[model samples]
Target: MSGFSSFWASQNKVFRISIILLLLASITYGQGNRKPFAIEGKLNLTSWDIDQNPIELNGDWFFYWNQILTPQDGLLSFNQENKNIKSFPGLWTDYEGDTSYPSFGFASYLLIIEGLEKDKEYALKVPDMYCSYQLWVGSKLVASNGKIGRDAESYEPEWRPVTVNFVAERETESILLNISNFDHSKGGIKNSIVLGPVEHLASQKTNEVAANLIRIIGIALISIISLAGFFLYSKKLFTYFSIFSILWSVRGIFSNMYLIYSWIPDFNWTLGTKIEYLTIYTSVLVGYHIFHNLFPNHSNKIISWASIFINSTFIIITLVSPAVMFTELLNIYFGLMGLLLAYILINVIQAYIYDEKGAGYLAVAITLIIILFFYDMLSYYKFLPYNPYITSIGYVILYGLLGYTLRYNQLHKSKDTTFKFS
Candidate 1:
């Protein structure tokens, strides 16, 4: 294992390049945007009243500076010397008061809104900034994130909406926003905050070209791994692959275009959104299998327990009401997937340390998957700057691991058969 690990360490450069190229190729070829704008039909509500609920205007918000819409992290920060640095959408301390926030340059954001209720209250909240901010509703100052003392706990941006009640004089509308960065005195400042819609809208497509490429790559890898498993199947391999493939295939149906058009023909606008959540739920089970395969322990007891725990939790949330589980389930799946991936990587590392032949390949594969997974996870919660094209990198890794296992088992069987015949 040590020898194998050393070998991988020596070839890290080559492995990294290959994995990155493979990931890029997958995204480019497999997950091309088939429908730039396909209505899932889920939002076909009968009444103007239901649609009138305050929807969060967070999705597809654009940043405009000097009359140009800037991409995510487009603000170039500068010091007193005026050198360019990085910036984003959140509160930052200027190394002032006891707890200063990060500083950033000025940037304006605009959100396009549809189906908003008139004569209703809506809040444009930035959780906490501990500093200063200004909010505008169509050029009207709704609430300014005014400067607050760092000593005040409420001064920080809390993960809550800053409410703004308004009487919409007209039916359809949009919001123009201007946020100033006054943290010049603060040391090396950046902002990264999520602009929220009242209700979660269809994930706004991100204009991040790198992230989109990652998604396409993930999809292609998943397709290849799925095919790989199908081609090399022994009894055990077939059983596992059957379960894995069916689960993801069903999940893909809910996620990809095929299911949207077939199953829920009369889609409510929210149906597609709902299916996206469901895909996360099912992917938890998929993670369980991936972990079990990659980090096989002498005893299956722990894996069984973990599976039960995950399913039980999901079942309980579903029983309580789906909405209760929305954010919570996402968090759960995210944590579980992370743990599974970590365990697999650890096993691969251990295998390499023990001089195992295939551990290096597995490690490279896991590394690529993790890179893609982190981007998707961050994008899902709006933590990372990305477009809504969710990358399927983790799924690709899981299927690849499954395929490798099946292939290894079949080869072992063939070798054993040859020995016996001889």
Candidate 2:
């Protein structure tokens, strides 16, 4: 008992330090050399240094609702009074300038960037918008994803993050974005556009892709090892965890950097969206089974069965329904999953109180998962600032802890077998 206490005490200290470091890092990264945002469609960066960090082109921008205006049209026809100011990195559904806007519609966004170094090369990182978009930098169409149109028949929806590089032709530049969404529940720019030095933005993109690749590779390895362990030992715990990890790996590929699209550029967006949702649903089912198996005495059978049934139903709906329909169910799923996670947390805590093997480690892992889950939800809904890599970081730490707990259990079981034989 004393040895266990001592071990747990050391682990607790390590866990606390790790959490503190993670929070400090998040804060530091979130506030990295902040710059002023655009106000009423203009961003002044004359005195701001571009070498410091990439700037998110957030704040108010000239929004022309229901009008797919081009650079020529905007320059010749529209003036300051003709435009409506709307915040960037937000959906048109939330736009309430002159009137309410629905999720489906076409719109044009314009932002004039002032004080750029003339003739210097810069890069703009455009995130995945709702359905389709075309971007023009000073009358030259620089980059586009999918096909943009004024309505559903003419519009084609595609989602891909792109970085455009162009030289600054003048001290001030104009950016025009024509976006249209007819197939999804949300429309308009969903994420901030990033601008920085060409080399800096390029390096940043490379680092992000590399990090995502590493995480996917790591999760894939864990799934493979867990499956091999299951086959060798015939343990249901290993099987459950293996499935859980595999689902997460699939989800990871489809999300964050959308790495799968790089490999299959023509992959169907609807199918990809379904796979994303199905992975989440199935992961919860498998994850709950893992905990129930680990602490059967503490886990409630009713809740376990209920989770299984609900998740299974969700999986079926996601597989059959269209992206627009199934995507709306995600918020409801999150609410249910939150309750399920709370139940699992309570069970883990009970197991730890009763000194169940590996409970302490698992409790910590589950706690971290809960925190990251909420963080991701808030971030997704635009309630909080986006951090693309935090959830991946949390999952990596979770897998490490689970791996340690599994090894610890195996080692102790081997000792028990040896003692019995002796």
Candidate 3:
């Protein structure tokens, strides 16, 4: 224990510094870095250059709760008394205005952009909303995702991030969106809708797609390598890690950019969502097994079995139930995962205390994973501001450390064998 204490004390500063740097990088990356935002459905960007900085169409937009208005209806046709202002990049459930808004409902969002050069080629980057949405630019229906309906039966949920290009016919433009949600727990535009020059938006979308592809490819490569390692070496650790990597890769396809749907346009939404949730639940389960295998003496058998039971139950629930029913279990699952990680960390510490091979590296990786996990959880619940692609950053760092640890262990084992023979 004294040895462990001294070792941790010596490395504490370095670890904290590394984590802080990572956190800062994650917070700052891909944040648009624009201060200008919409106010009461109007954004003035006369001075701003769209080519230089694509603005996130965030902030207060003219929200018509429970009313799905169209460009044909005219923005002014809505009841003045029912007019409400709601902030974007957030769910309607968070709205606290004239009337309380439920998670599942239909609404219209209107944002008027002023001070644009007439007839200039510009683009709007529309992210995947809660379920389905239709966008209109000055009475022209430019883009839509799935079919937006007032009720569940008529609603068809689809997730496809789109970049729509248009020529600014006038100096001011009215952007109207009719969005509906009945399939998911959260509704409304939760992600930023970006507005910028056509070329810039296209470049940005290309870069984003490229990054997501790289991440998915990297994870898939790890899984393949781990699987090969398992087959060659017949190690349980390799098998578990391979499963973890594979699950995350599938999750990456469904999440972030929803690349799978892009590749297969007719992919089922509910199935994709189910796979996403299953991957998360199973990845943690596999992660626990990895830790248990590393330091079996430190792992409690009863606790391990209990965890298995709980994760199995969650997996079963996800498979059998509707998306709405299974999605609500995420908060509870996050709490359980926190506890599970704590236990795993304690075992890793024990392994480190005994001077187990590669334990130090494992400890560092797990610590970072826990930090990122909490950050993601808080961001998901809106307790903290969310950062796009932050999880991918965390995964890159975590997997790098894990890969190094694996290599270190293998090298040391070979050396030990050679020494024994000598």
Q: Which residue pairs collide, candidate 2?
A: none
| Per-residue accuracy of model 2 over 1-422 as CA lDDT, tens digit each | 99977876778677879778678767765665356788888899988887686788888888888888878887653465666788997898877655888878898998889999888888999888888899998878988878899878898777778788988899988999999988777778878898998887887788778777767777878888887876676554676677888888888889878877778888888888788888999888877777766666787767877987899999988888777778878899999988887777787888889988888998888778778878887665444665446766667778867866665555445332121100
Worst 10 residues of 1 by lDDT: 35-44
lDDT of each: 0.43, 0.79, 0.79
Number of the top TM-score candidate: 2
Task: Rank candidates, TM-score, best first.
Answer: 2, 3, 1
* RMSD score of candidate 1 (Å): 16.8
Give the higher-lDDT candidate: 1 or 2: 2
TM-score of each: 0.40, 0.85, 0.83
Candidate 2 least-lDDT 10 residues = 413-422
Window of ten residues with lowest summed lDDT in model 3: 413-422
A best-first ranking of the candidates according to their lDDT comes to: 3, 2, 1
